[model samples]
Target: MMNFHFIWPLSGGLLIGLSAGLYLLLNGRIAGISGLTASALGWTSGGVSILGLGFIGGVLAGAAAVFALLGHAGLTITSSPILLVVGGLLVGFGTRLGSGCTSGHGVCGLARLSPRSMVATMTFMIVAAITVYVTRHLVGGF
Candidate 1:
């Protein structure tokens, strides 16, 4: 069976909504992954640390389950571990500089109608567009 479904965009949206709503109603915290992870890493808030780790674990587990069902055919690109690591590092750095990742700023922050989040989301969108353009045309690699 071909499972050509956008599960995360749908199910992940639901989970994010639930998390955000619960965070506000019960804890009064926004479900921003970068903020949560920063607090967790800095040990500033133990509660956020636990939630951040759980959120990350859930995301990874969900991705792994999807890949298992999808058979992991296009997981690799360019066949370079070093490039992949470098790319990951750059992404993390950008996320830090931007103060929130796509999920946080794009989904949670925007939903909460935060001006900071609005700008941050726009930055991500613009940066992503430039990245795709460079990757597809300028650099020309898969």
Candidate 2:
């Protein structure tokens, strides 16, 4: 039997919603992590550098706090380190190609009822399912 921690996902969704809502409300900007990270590179004194940094910092700090309190949620990764890096790079590339990520499209876009985001989100999910099936069941047995 698989054990599921429900509050973790719920809290994550709340934080994502809160972050996105707050950013839009305060700065009149859409809260996209990729865009924020990319723009942070060209960050000047003002113009959301602090805002972006604070939002991201809060996410990291929150994760650390959770781990510290929970004493490691006991998750493990089976993929090799190199494969993980390559997979991350590929996902980043795909996000750039698609103009957003699962979080941006699936969460915020779906919330706003965007047709384009709906298509993008569904396409990404289908592709992800196919990839996982092929990697784990097909090629994984080789």
Candidate 3:
């Protein structure tokens, strides 16, 4: 018998990796969500990439499909609106500062064996662990 707990996450990871790989192979672009988003919004020099818009649309569509199927039963956000906003702002700033997000560095960059991505991913993991510990143990909340 197999433990079912890991199956869903494992499957999701495989799907993400496959999609990223396929997107790169087909488009000659790294599927970095932050960069794609910036390009789609015309923040980048190209004045809006169709491919970036398509990628964003696909992601939203996929999320909508999942919500339609699952009905948001297991989804919960315990954070306050202010905290969420602050977090979002921080993430955006960090993405700009780091030149990429986790999807870019962790998945695509790591796949390409980028040294910068390696260091970035390690920093991300360590910071994440520290954040989790502080929030769970020190600050005390889910």
Candidate 4:
């Protein structure tokens, strides 16, 4: 069976919630990574908001720090570069089409008890389950 490590996961979840709450409290903004990234990249109307750029930088720095401290042995991608690129493009498109990413709907919106977020989160979970089933069972995932 799978080994369950509750402490790390719980800590991570708490950190995420705390960070999101802090962002909202400080900036009056929802901590959605996709929106922040888009704004940082100058794709949004404001054209590279400093707030978004700072948040993205913090995210990257935090990830690098974690990787440096813990060492991620399983971080290598098994799929082809083309597949990875395509997957990323698809995810970006899907996030735009959906008006928000999983973090936005699942974390912030759900926390606020939003009906639209409830529907979006359910859709995200269902689609993820279907994708996993198809990849693992039907196509044999890499």
Candidate 5:
């Protein structure tokens, strides 16, 4: 029998992929969350993309809906506040340096067969594995 634990995540992944695919197909834009955020924040020369704002709003709404429905019963934050802040900062820096986030590179870029996205995604995965190993074994506190 199949494990029920995977069903929710599988459904979420399908929804994400469908959204990204539709966004790309309709808008002719890559659904890179970082880029969208930057554009929405008016950091880009384009001066506040409406599409970016809409995408961000949709993501937030979806997350809110999920939380409302699920009520955070199984949710837990094991990391300290400082750790989480630092991790968020690092992720922001990494996303900027990488030119895109996982959604853009791993999902959309891979679907489009982009070489840069491919490399970025591989690097992200490798670095994540190394970080996990170090934190869990070498560092001993994470």
Candidate 6:
């Protein structure tokens, strides 16, 4: 049997929701990491580019702080460098093609009850499940 730790997951979810809500309330932003990353890279055309960069910086800093405090015991990635790069590229492409990433569609969009987001989220979930099944069962497994 698998042991489930509920407190950490719940805490993480609450933090995510709170941050997304605050971002939306304060800056009228969706807190989508992919969109913000594009904007930070100067690919997005608008006045929010600077804010996007700041947000990205904040994300990095937060991650660094967490690692520094927590010591990264179970957070190590064993994937090959090439696989990681390819996976990142694929995810970026998918985010662009889908018009939004999970954070935007799954979290923020669902919160607002958007039909488009509902469809997108459903598609994302289905595809993710398929990918996991294929990778874990058909392939050697991740």
In the range 1-142, model 1's lDDT, one tens digit per residue, is: 8785677568877877887777767877767776777765664544456666776677678788878977875544664798778888998898878877887788778887989989998888888899889888999765
- Candidate-wise lDDT, in order: 0.76, 0.81, 0.90, 0.88, 0.92, 0.86
Worst 10 residues of 3 by lDDT: 66-75
Candidate 2, run of 10 with poorest lDDT: 39-48
Model 4 clash pairs are none
Q: Candidate 5: worst 10 consecutive residues by lDDT?
A: 66-75
Off by over 4 Å in 4: 1-5, 73-76
Highest TM-score: which candidate? 5
Residue-wise lDDT of candidate 5 within 4-56, one digit each (tens)? Answer: 98887998999899999998999898988899999989999999999889989
Alpha-carbon shift of residue 95 in model 1 (angstroms): 1.9
TM-score of each: 0.74, 0.85, 0.89, 0.88, 0.92, 0.86
Query: Of the candidates numbered 1 and 2, which has the greater TM-score value?
Result: 2
Give the C-alpha lDDT of model 6: 0.86
lDDT of 2 by residue, 1-142 (tens): 9767888889888889998887777887677777676666544345557666776787789989999999986788877888889989998998899998887788778888999899999999899999989998989822
Clashes of each: 0, 0, 0, 0, 0, 0
Model 2's lDDT to the true fold? 0.81
Residue 91 Cα positional deviation in candidate 5, in Å, after optimal superposition: 1.1
Q: Which regions of candidate 1 fall more than 4 Å away from where they truly are?
A: 1-8, 40-48, 64-76
lDDT of 3 at 111: 91
CA lDDT of 19 in candidate 2?
A: 82
Instruction: Quote the positional error of residue 33 for candidate 2 in Å.
Output: 1.6
Cα error, residue 119 of model 5, in Å, equals 0.8
